[model samples]
Target: MNEFKKTNIENPVVVIGGGASGMIAAWRAASLGVPTLLIEKNKKLGIKILISGGGKCNITHDGNIEDLLKSFQKNEALFLKPSVYKFNNRSILKLLEERGVETYTRDDGKIFPKSNDASDVIAALEWYLRNAGVEIRTDCSVQEIIFENNCVTGVKLNNEIIYSSNVILATGGVSYPQTGTTGDGFRFIEKTGHTIVPLRPALAPIKLSNKFPYGWGGVAIRDAELICLVNNRKTHSERGDFLFTHEGISGPTVLELSKYAAMELANNKVELILDTQPDKDATMLDSEIQQLIGLHPNKQIGNIAGLFLPNRLVNHFLNSINIDPEKECRKLIKEERKQLVKLIKEMFIGTIDTIDITKGEVSAGGISLKEVDPKTMQSRLVKGLYFCGEVLDIAGRIGGYNLQAAYSTGFTAGESAAINYKSQSTTP
Candidate 1:
C-alpha cells in the first residue's frame, strides 16, 4: 500500500460532497475513527435529498444485492453488485435507524423515512456524521484538485489550497442544478487527468411532442409498459407510470428508459408506444370490443369505448380511425372499429426529445466501469485514488436504487481507503 505522506492537516479524510454518497462516505470513515471532513457547495446539504421522491426521499430499496443489481442496466448494475453485497440496503437501514431515522418499506420495496418526510432522512444522516466527528464545510466550492505522481494530494477551494493526504471525491451528478449539482465535479475530473465518458442524462424525464391532458398529470400507469420504437421497431420497454409534465412524460418508465430513449433518438426521431394493456393480446381486446359492439348495436361506439379507457382517449382513438362518434355501433366499418381498438390497446406517440444529461438523476457515462475495481470502487488506472457514487459510470433506475448504489459504493470506498491508509501508515 502506498502511503500519502500526511501533512499537518487535522482531518485525515476529506470528502468533497455532502450529498447522499459523500455524507455516507464521511460518516463511515469517521465512524472508523478516521478524522474526516465533508464539503458542500450548497448553503445546506441534502437539499436534493429532501426534494427526492417528492420530499419523501426514497432512502433505499428493499431486497438483497442480487435484486438490487437487476434494477440497473448495462455494466453499471453488474459493477455495483460486489460493493452492494458488502454494504447493501440492510446495513444502510440499520445505520439510519440507529441514528433515529425510523424507516419502513413500501409494498414495492421502496424504503423511506417512517414519517415519509425526506427532512428526517437528511437529519439522520447529518446527525450521524456530526456524532462521528466528521467536519463539515457548507457553501464552499472546490476550484480545482491538487495531485502529484498520479495520486490526489488536496483540493483548491475559494483560491485557498487546503491539503489532505487522502481525498474522496463524492460530488454528485449534474442534475437538479438548483440543488447545487452544477457539474462542477466534471471540471475536477478533467483536471485530475481522468477520462470522462460522454456525459448524458440518465434517469431523467423525456420530452414528448404530443400534448397530453393535464388531468392525467398525476395519473400513473402501473403495470403499463412503455415501448420505445425506432423506425417502427421496438427498441426498449419498461413497465411503470409516466408522470405527465406540462411538457412530457417522466417518472419511472421515462427515467428507466431515458438512456435508451436518448440513444434511439440520437438520430433524431423515435416513437413511444404506450401499451396500456401489455398483457392482454390484440385478440383479447378484439373479443371485448366484439362483445361491447354486440351489446351496443344501436349505441354510438364512442360511448362504449370508455369501458376500456378514459372518455377522452376513447374519442381520440375513434377519431384516428375516422369512426364517427354519432354513428351507431352496427354502422361502424368492421376494419375501422378494429383499428380503433388496436390503437386503444397500443397507443403510439412520437417523441420530441430526451431530457438533458445535466438534468439526469445520476449520470450514466463516467470514468467507465472497466477502469475501476468493483470490489473496492477504486480506479484501476490510479494507484491509491478511488471513486464512488454518480461520478463513476454507474447509474441505476429510479426508486431509490441509484442512491443505494451511491451509499454502497461510498461505503466500500471508505473502508478500502481507510484500510489502505492504515497499511501505508504501518509500512516502514
Candidate 2:
C-alpha cells in the first residue's frame, strides 16, 4: 500500500463529480501529497463507468497518440494533443493494471477489463482513491462554484460551502441524466464567465420519419455505408454495421454520424442513403445480377437476391420498388433489373425526425475548447479552476476514445492543480 504524506496546505483540492474523470483527478491530486476531496451527486462513484460499453466498460482505445487523435475533429484533436500525449491509453492501462484491473483490446481496438465486468473497473478506481487518501462524499450536490476575484475559492453545496485551494469541475455533460450528468458543470461554468457552445446529442440513435418495414426491427446490415444527404446532396457518410430499430437506426455507423444528422435535420431535410453493396458499383452489381439470372433462370428473383442480403430486407426492398418477389429471374425485365441495382447501390431510407439527447452516448458542445488551456485543463478566464471530461466541447467517436479523453484530461488537471497548490503554499 502506498502511503500519503501529510501536507502543510490548509485547503484541499476539491473535485466535482465522481465519474471516470473526477475519480482519476481526485486520486492523482491526493497521490501528489495534496489533500483532495471528491464529491458525487449520485449514491456511488463511477455510475456511468459501470454502464459504459454495455456494462463492460470501454477503458480506452488501443493505438498510438497520432492514430487515436484522428478519431476526433481537427480542432478537437489539436486541443487534446497535449494532455493525451502526456497521459495516454498506455498510461491509463498501466495505472489500472497496477491496481489489479487487467484489460484486453478488442479487434476494433477497444480496451476493456479482462473479466468483462465494469464493476471491476469501478472497484479498482475506488480502491486507488481510498489508498491515495482521497475523501469522497456521495449524495451531495453542488449548487454553485464560489469564486472571488475570478479565482476559485470553493464549491457551494446545498447545506454548506466546502473550501478548496483548487477546484476541478469534472461534472460531465447532460447525457445520461439518470447517471447524474445533468449539465451542472455547464451552468456553474457559465456563471463564471465562460462561453458554452450549444449542447446537443452526439453519438445517439437517429429517429427516422419512415418507420422500419414491419418486422424489420433488430435486423442489422454488416459492412454497409450510410450516407447523409441534404437537399439531395451527400454531406457526410460512414461505413460500419447498423441495426434497424422500430423508430430508426442505431449502431456504430448511425451513432457516429448522428451528430451531423441532427444538425442537418434542424435546418434542412436529412435523408439516409444506405449502400448495402458498397464494394460494387452500379454497373458491376447490374452485371452480376444479369449473370445470376442467366445461371438460375427458373429461380425466383427473391431467392436469387437472398444470397446478397437478408431475406426479410430483400423482400422489403422489392415491395418498395413495386417488384414482385414471386417473379422468376427469367421474367425480370431490364428496367426491373436496373431498379434492383440502384436499390442495392443506394437505397434512400428517408428523412431523420430527431436525435434523442437523453439516449446519446455522449453530449457534445459543452464549455468551448478555446475557453480552457489544453495543456493544464485550467480555465483561461479563471485562476485555479479546471474543466475536464465531457463537460468540455471534446467528444470522440465510438470505441473507447471518449474514455481516453476523460482519463488524459483528468490526469493533467489534477497534476497541474497539485503543482499550483504546492507552489502557492510554499511561498512566503
Candidate 3:
C-alpha cells in the first residue's frame, strides 16, 4: 500500500472524489477542526476544473442569489435555493480572493480568474485543502460504500477499507469520462439505497441528421434564434450566437436547448427551426426586400440577399429554394420572394440525430434531490452520508452556474458533516 493509503485516522470525514465539490467539502470539514480525507481516482485533482471554459476556468457567475437562481431550471432552482443562498457567488469569490486567486466577470456575467489560468483556481483550492490539514489521497478509487442499519460506516477499496463516521460523495456526473467522472458515484449512491435519476447529457453540442455543407462547418450566425419543435409543435426557443458544425449545430443557443432536444428526440421527431433574421418578421422582411428590389432592379437577387445573411448562407438558401443566383432582382416573382422571406424568417435547419454525452459540458441527472436535505446536503435516507456537486440531480446552464452549484453544495455538505460528526463524538 502507498504511504498515503496506509495512514488512516479514526472517525475522519472521508470525501469521495476530488473534483470541485469534493475539494471544497474536504476543505470546509478540515477547516472546522475535523479530520477530513479526500480520495481521488485520478493522479491529480480538478481535471474538470482545469479544462473548464476552454482551460480558462469560468469559476462562477456574477449576480445576486435571485438572478443566479433564475439561471437554473424550475425544479433545480427550487432545490438549489438554500445552498446557493448560503454560498453565493460573492462568497465564493471572496474565498478565492483570500487564497490569492483574483477573478473578473465578463459583461455576460461569466466569471474567470483575472490571470486567465485555470491552474490558478485549482492551485488555490489545493492550497486551502493542504493548509487546512485535509489528507488527500490520489489514484485511490472507492469500490463500494459500507453501510449498515441506515448509516454509512466506511468506503471499501480494492485492497482495503477506510472507515469514517461521515462520508461526503462529491464525485461529479458522468460527463467527460476522461476526467474520471465515469458514473461511479451513482453506483455507490444506489447501493446505499438512494434514488438515482436517469442520467443524460446537458449543455452538449447537438448532432443534426443533415450535415452542413462542406464549407459551412465554421460559419456562425450571429443574433440567430433557434427554436425546438416536437411533433411539429414549437416547444422551446433561444436567441444567441449559433455555430454550424460538420455534424450539427453548437453555441450558446443550441447548447442551452440541447437537453430538451435530447429528451424529446426519444419519442418525437425533433427539428431545429433557425430564424436567421430574428429581428424582423416575415411581412416586414418581405417589405424590406421589395424596397431593395425597387432600388436595385438590375442587381442579382443573391447579392441583395447577401446583405441580410452571410454570402455562403445566402447561396445555400437560394439553392435550397430553387432560385438562380444570376437572376436579376427585377425578374424575381412574388412567390420566389415569399419563399426567400420564409427562408429568412423560419428556416428548418435539420433533425437532431443524437446528443453525445462525452461532448456534454455537464451531465443532467444524478442522485435525486428529494433524498437529500438541500440546506445541509445530508442524505435523508442514510445517516453520515451527504451528497453534493454534480452527483446530485442539479445542473445549471452554461456561464459558471454549474461550478457555483458545486461550491455551494460542497460547502453546505462539508460544514454539516463536520458539525454532525463533532456532535456525535461529544455525545455521552
Q: What tens digits encode model 2's per-residue C-alpha lDDT throughout 1-428? A: 43423334446689999998998888899999999989999999999999999999999998899999999999999999999998899998988899889999889899999999999989988999999999899999988888889999888777676777699999998888999999999888767789999888899988888877658888888988999999999999999997888766787889988888887777898899988888998898989999999999999999877766667788878988988998999999999999888887788877888888889999889998998999899998999999889999988999999989998899999998998899888899
Off by over 4 Å in 1: 1-11, 191-193, 213-222, 243-246
Q: Which whole-number lDDT from 0 to 100 does residue 201 have in model 2? A: 87
Clashes of 3: 0
Tens-digit lDDT track of model 1 for 1-428: 43334345634677888888888888888888887878899899888888888798999898877888888875877788788888899988998888788988899899989888999888888998999998899998887777787777787776466776577778777777788877777787675557888777788777776787666565455567888888888888888765555566766788888887787677857888887777788888888788888987999887877666556456766776777777888877779767776776677755656568767777677777787788886666565567788888777877798889889988988777777667667799
Candidate closer to the true structure by TM-score (higher is better), 1 or 2: 2
Judge candidate 1 against the unseen true structure and give its global Cα lDDT, from 0 to 1.
0.78
TM-score, per-candidate, Cα-based: 0.91, 0.94, 0.95
Best by lDDT: 3
Worst window of 10 by summed lDDT in candidate 3: 1-10
Pairs clashing within candidate 2: none
lDDT of 2 at 417: 92
Between prediction 1 and prediction 2, the one with superior lDDT is 2
Report the C-alpha displacement of residue 306, candidate 3, in angstroms. 2.2
**Cα lDDT of model 3 by residue, 21-134, tens digit:** 999999999999999999999999999999999999999998889999999989889889998888889988998899889888899999999999999999999999999999
What RMSD, rounded to one decimal, does every model reach?
3.7, 4.5, 2.4
lDDT of each: 0.78, 0.89, 0.90
Off-target runs (Cα >4 Å) in candidate 2 are 1-10
Query: At residue 367, what lDDT does model 2 achieve?
Result: 90
